[model samples]
Target: MQIPTKFYKIIAIFSLFFLGILIFLGVVFKIIVEKRKLPRLYIEEKNRALRGSIISAEGYQVAYSNKLYKVAVNTRCIDPQKKELFVRLFSIYSKIPPHEVRQKLRQKRGYVVLSYTIDTKTAYQLKILSRKLNALDIFIPYKVGQRVIKQGLTILESGETRNFPYGDTLTPAIGYVSKYEDSGYTKIKGIKGLEKYYESKISPKQDGVIRGKRDIGNNIILNKEAFIKKRLDGYNLHLNVNMLLQKNIENILDTQKADLEAKEIIAAVMESNSGKILAIASSNRYDPKNIQKRDLPSLNPKFTEYPFEPGSVMKPMTFSLLLEHGLVSPLEVVRGYNGRMKLGRKYITDEHKFDWLSAENVIVHSSNIGIAQLAQRLSYLQFSQGLKMLGFGKPTGVDLPYEKGGKLLPPYKLKSEIYKATVGYGYGMTVTFMQLLSAYNLFNNDGYKVTPRIAAFITLENGKRIFLKKSKKRKILSSKTVATMHNILQKVVEKGTGTVAKIDGLEIGGKTGTAHISRGGRYQNAYITSFFGFANDAKHRYTIGVTVFEPKTKHFASQTAAPIFRNIVIELINEGYLIPKNEQ
Candidate 1:
């Protein structure tokens, strides 16, 4: 084991040299691994480029994005000596003053957005100015601006607008969206109508995730770099509104606008069988061209935003309630004359003087006294329950923003004569036109109440049509009550104030409502006009409601609203809403 001194020294030196070589190799390997796994201290500077498009049900692009430039100033790269020159050049090019730019630079630690969505001409000018001024820190990032329809077949040229080629035609129903600057981010928000209701699905989130594709090796690869995520665009909506029917209704409203002297008009046409809204029109509509100055008044009418006493239009609903409870047969006799009766200090009267009338006559004549007597006879609890059954005091579950749930005063609150009388004739309490229409379904359908909906289906970008689900129906009245009320309402168009609403060729039924507008809690002589219509082909079928608020000349529904109903029904007949006599 022992060797010579010279050989031992040689072995020791070789061993030490080998150990030194091993340590150096280990150090080199460690440095390489550390470099490969090094955590970067700098933040990943990302430029957000967002865009959205609006397309019709048929995939016609209504609104789409166009290229724009996003200009930003990288404060970190701005030289102290050239800061003033950079601010001056930006101010001159961007129309922003130098003081503001300087203030922004002082407050900002990194990059500061100067302006977004600049036109190409302005963007180029700024780029040229930055180069001339030697402001290399100015960054002009290209992006897509929200495309607004300037003009199209079913759209109009408006300022960054979501337009219906039909303008103001479906304003109350379809709704509009607009861009807003809030909390340092630009956003497009749905303010009303269907825009607000289905915003989530229609307007996709920016942080949406995307799944990556697999490789051929059959082993999962950890290649985060290969996959890319982009912002998902919102889905397109196809409404239940029949274009032909909607156009016809709009024309009808236009034709009657002058005579009615109305401030606003709204009409809704629905299929009584399925509760699908066929057409909805709101008058005083603005051009979707100027979305920034959206005329909220005309866009949202009495249907959704405004609630008022519905007058005798609610008679069928009340009658349905009574008949449903078996409290009164349609033929049950009630005494009323001189058009007035006093109950519990509340005086009730019909518009015209009347005598003993059947329950059917009460609805036919819209006898306020007769209805009030009936209300007196029924327990308050029963009346409230019946109102609830008819979908009163509740939202129709309509997919619209700010849908009003009209107020229904509790029975205990009806201490005054005015309140009771008004309630009997659709006063004191307020209900939206949509709520009234939904409640009116009790007479047309088999006692079932279904929520109204605007969206027929949602079309994905890939051309998939997914039908929006409809709400379940609840039995609000007995089948017998519906049948009886149908007969009574039919008589209303045949012989009562609603006779003007009758279509010549088809059997039509409806009610006329002329409710006094309450000013400061007192009923004024001015009235809100209203008409409700039901058409049948040897059986109850379609229901429509039309309302015109605060007509200057004719305040009665029979005069102002009825003609609109007549025109709508005529168009519906022409479109084959009526069965042929031979077919029937």
Candidate 2:
């Protein structure tokens, strides 16, 4: 207040000069301090590995993952002067209309999507186009709204998508996968069948991460000091399925499905000695790549999931159990009740009647009364325990997902004569198609139960192969008992209920079953016809099973399922997978 005007002007000048210097030092300090912290505050980018593949036994890639791309345009960065050129180039590469491209570019938004799924070839071409535009300075790098437009074209990996080269072939067995949002990240997950069963082994658990410093432009600084965490890719699964054989089976089922007027058909072929599934097919298959809502019903593996009362097919198993316990002999004769008999309120009947029948003939003829009478001789514990040992009432431990172990009444229930008699002829219990097939396999495999498996091995990305552990066969019957049952089953095809399945030179042994489909606690008009059998010469041995649900044309399995079994044998021989002994 006391100073002169010139002194006050000098003091104001000094104050202004010091204030400018302090501001400069503060700016310098912020730049230096933030820059120093840049190494600690890194920009992290993750590179996820592709999902593993599913390889068929014949080395065909049934299911595999393919990398796709997402293409988008940064409208704000694109040069306004070269809009025509940009539209033309982008439209050509993206397979989109030029006018559409112009429309997208004209939008006020900084980012606009052009395509979500483009193949590698198209993505590469578009990336090349992006580089060319950048070389020509066609992108005006600047901030628009919240996005910094460093480039006009953006091509990013949209993650891997599953591809099935064979389309609908082996569906529900090869299974399917889908994309889902998990914690703000997109992930591909298996939805059904083997894909879901082996999800842990088939899906990548960890992704690669690169942590590095960024410059003022927020771009990753390329230096050797960057931290990198390598990605661990999933293991590749190898199935026991033979694609060619699987296709053949599907084709046969398709032809038979139309002729039989079946609601659905399921078939499977397995090696007798080793529990490897050779081919499993269904008539109601859908393409895993393009699944529709209607295909939902056919998405689960029916062979392992579907369970029904397996009618006469259980005769051989029951007979084998009786033989193992010395309760019945092949030549022993019993009353057949002339095709009908009453046991506790319900009547047991045969298609054709006989006053008396030999034990082996009871099986060959599928005499419900005779087998039931013979089964009653054994205690309830013996019968129940015997079937359980044969792998009934339990999952087959198969590699497929959603396997159902059909219901088997407890041994205490079998104490009732009605339950005992009904179960002896394959009622009072339920079994899946796979269980029946595997149980029948015991006879062919020398009474040793071999657990069925669809997958054979797994391979790592490092060229290491991990084979499945070999499971020892569990013996359920003596070799002599198996031989006796084998001869009995052979007679069933030669002249008995399964004669329709007999080929000229190829000897097939099997049992035919026809069970009423139950709905709302009542048996319906629909029937489930099945044929479970095996064919073997010196060179090859295979167990084949076929089930036709609600066949409109026929009721008896001998007419519906037996012929299908015969045709399958013919196909095996035709394909050189089997050799017939002699044909006159």
Candidate 3:
């Protein structure tokens, strides 16, 4: 009890030294535990690139991806005293009324959403405001639905959405996408048109990742470098479609559709030698950005999807084959049987009677009997193989999705003489508008069959371009045969059924076909009329096709379809194609 001052000092020093050792060991143990759990505490961040754009030939962005956001407010975390301040600030940035913001903040929930789709500018401003408010929140941890007297706000990132600048101009060809969710991640996938066809090339491929450590305060450590994996955006698709021209053609079809009371009008213009589709238009269109249930039926492009009996537009194809085989000549005489003749059990007839007609006049007049008479010269094998060579009963292999490769009766079916005669005039078979267009292009392209293409090339993120391979051209007819057919087709416009398609001072060639739409195994009163032709000058030529389905006002192609074909040519001339010298 009565120790000396020096002894007391020595005891105090030993006690202080042991206490210091214990504190040092505790600090080391805490550091070791934190280090062991560092992997779980490390921060992982990902950045995604924008989806690829769909660019038009005119350099317009037909379709693209844009970022969107969703904002939520922690109602329970908002200080009861500063509730008005939170509402005012949020209302100012979100463009929502203060009263509406107040109503949303009154909810007794963990987080209440204020806006599901705030724009980029608004989102950025709100994010800045969030950071400023978080200065105080950084020190205090807020739990879910705590009802604590504090200020708290949350902004969650929503995914990307597609934007269409031209509204519904491009239609089903441009296609559309639907949202898909896997695990906990969400994505948008193409479901139709060119979008579905080139999904791999136009969809995002990789997302950048960043791995780094965060401090206990959930802040990134500035001294440590993050490991990053570069993000890769999808490739851009540049199409062969001309936006202005496509609109022009669509306008033409719309006007004609209303005037003719036609159920539908489909048209396309293609470069003669290149097979590049300048424009593919339809009278019926729906918005890709906001599709409806009724719009679903209109999404399938009629140009590639719908097949029908092409009627007389197919006569030229059969005649070209006849010329190719030397089985018939333009000047050769054949009896027309006064417009009607029995081939097998059925009788073939023309619109006009004739005692005898030259083979050239047969095509010029679009005489069904005359063409059938010429077809009689060829055996079933010869006739069936000829249509097959003209790209019949096959898809044009367009880049667009859901292309139908129209049906052709087999040789056995053609063995029947009645079917053979009907086949010569575009019956007992079906073909799409694209196939018919491509078949007629041979006459304008000097007999070389060119494949139709909608996609021109693809551009990568690194400024490198990858062009789609061009389809190899096949020689299906001799140039001499082409010239003869061209002459006959030209006369059709100048003096026959296609005279309505003839423009003044411009030389055009085409054929007009009127076919009765069959329903329940019998021809109906409704008719499908069409005109397939070309607009040509010394310097340039373009193959154009127009089809009028179920015209209620007029049944003949010359009245319903040919005039539309003429208007298309005139529109081309107005757009500096085949312009006359005086107009130029």
Q: How high a TM-score does candidate 1 get?
A: 0.71
- What are the per-residue Cα lDDT tens digits for candidate 3 across 139-230? 13455463333445665556667888898887767888887664424467788888899998999989877787788656556454867788
Off by over 4 Å in 3: 1-41, 135-151, 183-185, 215-224
Q: Clashes in model 2: which pairs? A: none
TM-score, predicted candidate 2 vs. hidden true structure: 0.92
The 10-residue segment with the lowest total lDDT in model 1: 149-158
lDDT (10s digit) by residue, model 2, range 301-363 = 889988899888998888888888898889987998889999888888889799999989998
What's the distance in Å from true for residue 179, model 1? 2.0
Off by over 4 Å in 1: 1-166, 181-186, 206-227, 292-296, 299-301, 343-347, 414-421, 538-540, 577-584
> What TM-score would every model get versus the actual structure?
0.71, 0.92, 0.89
Highest TM-score: give the candidate number.
Answer: 2
Alpha carbon lDDT of each predicted model: 0.70, 0.86, 0.84
Largest lDDT belongs to which candidate? 2
Q: Provide the global lDDT of candidate 2 against the true structure.
A: 0.86
RMSD, each candidate, Å? 11.3, 3.1, 5.0
Q: Which 10-residue window in model 3 sums to the lowest lDDT?
A: 139-148
* Residue 207 Cα positional deviation in candidate 1, in Å, after optimal superposition: 7.1
Model 1, span 418-530: residue lDDT tens: 56455766877889999988877767887788888766787676888788888888876778777777787888999988888865556678888888888998889888888
Q: Candidate 1 — which pairs collide?
A: 64-147, 150-157, 154-165, 155-165, 158-289
